[model samples]
Target: MAYGYTGWGWPTGLRNGMGDAGLALGIIALVLFIAFPLAMILGVLALIFGGIGHARARRGEAGNRGQALAGMICGGVGLVLATLVLVLVVSTGDEEPNGRMDEGGYSATSVR
Candidate 1:
């Protein structure tokens, strides 16, 4: 009997592992982007992991290059959205003397 050449492949699972993780993190980040605080954290993580995954894919290690790239893009978009939300909240919150104004012309603190 002749043995087949099923020993090992050029690329290993390690590469795909990071790429898959990056893709998942990016998706989660995008989904939670509405939550500004969490978005920042998740976005950063996605970006980092996605960058690593992209590198691996570029080096012919991982097969999911598209996923890695998408993850990176999502992370960046999430970060931008989070920053915008934060800015809007801060700007609106500071518009009034107190925290915010109720339906009437009264300040939030005064109303309470």
Candidate 2:
């Protein structure tokens, strides 16, 4: 019997394609976690795609179950990290500088 051959034969290319995309997006999301919001967005997408891939695999309609699982793992971790960063930033209130200068007009102390 062929290895990894399901009785119903191989699933369509699209099924595996989603798994591949999920894996790639998951990796990207993990790497971009430093970007906070963007990472959260990518992580969400990765999870969605991974879920689809996983469903197909569970139904014996596709391969790459490992990839789908990996995607889900990365997406979950990345999303959590991004959310923490966002929360920290919001709580810390790291807003832009007020950009107010002294009215003394080019004082020596200001230059120093």
Candidate 3:
């Protein structure tokens, strides 16, 4: 009956909110893994929030530990996949269109 106070005394919804946000961000990250930068950012955020939520849950401060765990797992997987995709793109981008580089470090077609 007081400002910022719920029936359960102090509001514990903050932890659960973090868990929910983490889960949503993790799922979005997974869905957008091809956008490596965005996925990486989202994955990192998800991991952080999920970790916090999970820790709070473990301490009985919140109630959504399972959701937090799922978020952490998905975020980790997304982060790894995004890194792999980024590495693959960068590695492949260094090659010449014809699959060969000239002595001058330029593609043979670009030498002219």
Candidate 4:
């Protein structure tokens, strides 16, 4: 029930909280899941926070270990997916001269 190093307090509770945050962060950092940057931010937070959480959990933090693990996983996945989506979006595209997709389709102006 202590915030910081209060000499002698419970690490379990703190760790548990940290773990939960990590998990939540991982989940957030996804596509159509949380927000754009929010997810990314949270995901990173989860990883860092989760690592600390689990470490604390090892020091007797109730459920921080699990949270940390979850955070790492989620963050990884989120990063991958986010990167993929970004790449796809960025790489996918420039407009054709006719203002249409370059899938080989043409307008009547071409026919004339």
Candidate 5:
């Protein structure tokens, strides 16, 4: 029975589990998740629409190529915007003082 059941030579693991639909939707979700949050108000519409498009593609109601492309574009833009904002904040922000400043006009004269 063991010798006759030699169907182990089949290339099953080499293929995908969810095929193109899964890839398309997954990419869209991941990209939008990264982009929308990073972009703040700029990528809000893109995220919303990209999500809808991905869903539609998964359902076979829309094209996946477009959906995936849009998602990547929006996500990239958002990420860049978010990075820029972070850089600006870091560059312009001041460090908190460790010690309190003296309100009195005490000069740093040498005391004997």
Candidate 6:
């Protein structure tokens, strides 16, 4: 006997696609968290898509609630980490060197 088609396509629906995209972006953002600019961008997109997907799932418009939630959470954490790294770099960029080096490759300033 031949099985009948269930009529389900690859992505199924827009909301499902959003959930899938969100999950993928979230994972990428997390892995690239060291690159703050890229991570932030991907994280934001993941959050937006995941939020919409999750809302749709909750409303019975989609069926990937867990994936959406995971994406949102990972994106949020990655964004936070990226922001923290940015802050750390900015905060330390203006510090002056502790001491000047002499021709002999030793500190010119003497300890009191």
lDDT of 4 by residue, 37-67 (tens): 5655666777887787788788774665776
User: Model 2's lDDT to the true fold?
Assistant: 0.85
Of candidates 5 and 3, the better by lDDT: 3
Q: What is the lDDT of residue 77 in candidate 5?
A: 63
Candidate 6 structure quality by residue, lDDT tens digits, 1-112: 4988777568545457788889989999898998999999999999999998998899998888999999998898889889988998787665557643334544548634
In order, the Cα lDDT scores of the candidates are 0.81, 0.85, 0.88, 0.70, 0.50, 0.86
TM-score of each: 0.69, 0.70, 0.76, 0.61, 0.37, 0.72
Off by over 4 Å in 4: 1-15, 31-36, 95-112
Position 50, candidate 5: lDDT: 58
Worst 10 residues of 4 by lDDT: 30-39
- Residue pairs clashing, model 6: none
Error of model 1, residue 45, in angstroms: 0.8
Query: Where is the poorest 10-residue window by lDDT in model 5?
Result: 13-22
lDDT of 5 by residue, 1-112 (tens): 5556666586533222223433443344345443434355444444555566566667766555464446546554665666666676666555335545543655568435
Q: Listing every candidate in turn, what is its Cα RMSD in Å to the true structure after a full C-alpha superposition?
A: 6.0, 8.4, 5.9, 8.0, 10.8, 6.2
Ranking by TM-score: 3, 6, 2, 1, 4, 5
After TM-score superposition, the amount by which residue 49's alpha carbon in candidate 6 deviates from its true location, in angstroms, is 0.2
Q: In model 6, how large is the Cα lDDT of residue 76?
A: 88
Q: CA shift at 8, candidate 2, in angstroms?
A: 24
Among these predicted structures, which one has the highest lDDT? 3
The C-alpha local distance difference test score for the whole of candidate 3 amounts to: 0.88
User: What TM-score number comes out for model 2?
Assistant: 0.70
Candidate scoring better on TM-score of 1 and 3: 3
Could you give the candidate ranking by lDDT, starting with the highest?
Answer: 3, 6, 2, 1, 4, 5
Q: Once model 2 is optimally superposed onto the true structure by TM-score, how far is the C-alpha of residue 11 displaced, in angstroms?
A: 12
